[model samples]
Target: MSMFIRVKRKKTTYFLHCDPSETVLEIKQKLQALSENHVDDQRLILIANKLVLEDHKTLADQKVENDAIVAMTLKIRETGDWEEVVIDKPGEHPKPDTDAS
Candidate 1:
């Protein structure tokens, strides 16, 4: 069966259509296509358990299900480190005051 995952990074979210048997590395390759980031430079973390997805494991092996939310972190070329997760939500902004002075 086919499923989809919501891969989020900063303010962007990529809805990737995939299957349970697909390995995490495969997912990274697909993300690379859209993100232009190499598979080695990408890291995926399952939001539900905060578990880092393994490259050699299948999605089902990691218990990743349909419509799951995964955070994407990119490697910093300067420091050779993975950046922190930061998913911006649209509802996070404060609303303007409705009362007119």
Candidate 2:
């Protein structure tokens, strides 16, 4: 039988069905696409009854049944603001007004 999994991130949430053998990464990737967001180097965690799901751990490994409720929280990271670069006009230099000389 197929299992239904729920993922919550920020103010968004998603649901998907998977086989019992599906990994947490699979759910993470699917939720990322659904929310149109990119995952940072730090990964999301899946918890069921206060248990931390491992990377190589699958739902089947945790004995997750169908219609499981999963909790997702973001990993805090130190990030800086984006810098903008202003480019000068291509090969255009100011010349002295010698025409009137």
Candidate number with greatest lDDT: 1
Candidate 2: C-alpha RMSD to true structure equals 15.6
Query: Predicted candidate 1: what Cα RMSD to the true structure?
Result: 2.4
lDDT of 1 by residue, 20-101 (tens): 9999999999999999999999999999999999999999999999999999999999999999999999989789989898
Off by over 4 Å in 2: 39-48, 79-101
lDDT of 2 by residue, 1-101 (tens): 68787665444456787887877777667766776544443244444564556657888887677876566655444553321222234455677678975
TM-score of each: 0.90, 0.61
Which structure among the candidates has the greatest TM-score?
Answer: 1
Count backbone overlaps in model 1.
0
Instruction: For model 2, name the residue pairs that clash.
Output: none
Scored against the true structure, residue 45 in model 2 reaches a CA lDDT of 40
- Model 2, poorest ten-residue lDDT window? 80-89
lDDT of each: 0.98, 0.60
RMSD of each: 2.4, 15.6
For every model shown, the clashing-pair count is: 0, 0
